[model samples]
Target: MSRAQIEPGGCLILAGTPIGDFRDASPALRETLAEADIIAAEDTRVLRTLLQRLGVTTSARSVSYFEGNEASRTTGLMEEMLAGARVVVVTDAGMPSVSDPGYRLVAAAIEGGIRVTSVPGPSAVLTALTISGLPVNRFCFEGFLPRKAGERRRRLGALTAETRTMVFFEAPHRLADFLTDAAEIFGVDRRCAVCREITKPNEEVVRGGLGDLVSWATDHARGEITVVVQGAPARVVDIDGALARVRELVADGVRFSAAVAQVATATGMRRKDLYEQALAKREEHEDG
Candidate 1:
């Protein structure tokens, strides 16, 4: 195709590749691959395999664009587009920029006055969410948790009050630790679904409470794993009632710290705030 056939200022095409099943490749994806002047891929080897599987031959020059090199490679790709090349960006799976390398290129392209478009295709997030048996009306996607145990716990602790269902991508090896921390922070009884190898022949989804899932992951959690956890049950926060509960626990010989933890978990209040309030109430009673 000639320059006139491409967009006036050239175009940046973000194309979604199949998450697992190769048959899920769209015709638009094939066309974009075959006709583009340059193709930026997360993994060029994966892209070549995809092209071979789809029986599509492309004359387009392929370049590696991934997390490590994205910063340096984006400018060159943008320049190519500025020179009137139809540039297509694809990741190993799913949509580019969702949790992939295309975001930087898209931002740079826009800044450089190039037109950007997407050819939507399979998404592991949406696919897993729809079949997770959790409430889909409202949800949040947490791509991956921090590798460190302390950091992961802090992250999950911050979301303890989130009422919308949560989706998270996790590695197979860390699945047990992830679930264990999630159970401790979110509650052992919270419902969740562990969707593994989505859309592939051996796809499996294990549904249960966080505690049960933790036990199951000990031996069987393998492959690409997506965890969908049901949100915290909605509870009306009543400061007065929570303070009263704290006082009762304290009177029954519970330590101040222990009392605060119990009340916070029961009332969905921040433990630190509850502890301060309980301390103040104790001081007032002593003064009286």
Candidate 2:
């Protein structure tokens, strides 16, 4: 197949390759890969295999662009884009810079006034949410949890009151621990789904509360995992209780602002409201 011509100037094309299945790649991707003057692939071997699978031929120059060398290579890639090179960047799977490399290059290209376009493809975020059996009205993508148990718990603590669905990417090895911590922080009863090897032949979605899913992930699980966690239940307004707690914490030598933050975290109240109450309590303390 003949490759479509890319216009002259700094054009940075972020092409999305399939997450698992080869057939999932789009037509535009093949043409872009063929036409790009420089192909900055996450894995050159994978790119070669992908090309073979798609029966696409490319005489374009290939270079490795991943986490280790992303910073250094970004500068050179942007320079090429500025020189009117059609530069194409592809990750081993899915869109680049979505919890992956290519962010630095994209930022540099945009900063240099280059044209950055994308051939949109599959994403695990949307795919997991679609089958999560949780509320998707409002959601946030938290790429990965901290590896250590303590740090992971702290991260989950910080997100305790988040009322939107949360998504995370986890390696198969640590998935059990991640799910266990999630159960502790988000509550054992909180609904969640573990999506594994999405778009692959053995793609599976394990749906259950956090505790149940943790057990399921313990055995016979080896693939990419995307965990979707349901958010905490919304708290009812308790202005009087919140104000009282803030006042007590302040009297106990906790700084007024710090007290307010603590109260907000405990009560799931907006920090702004708690701050106003803390200010009033401080004024009362001074006057009294």
Q: Write the per-residue lDDT of candidate 1 for residues 207-278, one digit (tens) a residue.
A: 999999998998999988889999988889999899998788778997888878877876788888888888
In terms of TM-score, the best-performing candidate is 2
In terms of lDDT, which candidate is strongest? 1
Worst 10 residues of 2 by lDDT: 1-10
Question: Each model's C-alpha lDDT?
Answer: 0.89, 0.86
Model 2 misplacement above 4 A: 1-6, 239-263, 272-288
Please, what are the lDDT tens digits per residue for candidate 2 over residues 183-228? 9878999999899999999999989899988878899468888989
Off by over 4 Å in 1: 1-6, 240-288
What is the lDDT, from 0 to 100, of the residue 124 in candidate 1? Answer: 87
Give the total clashing residue pairs for model 1: 0
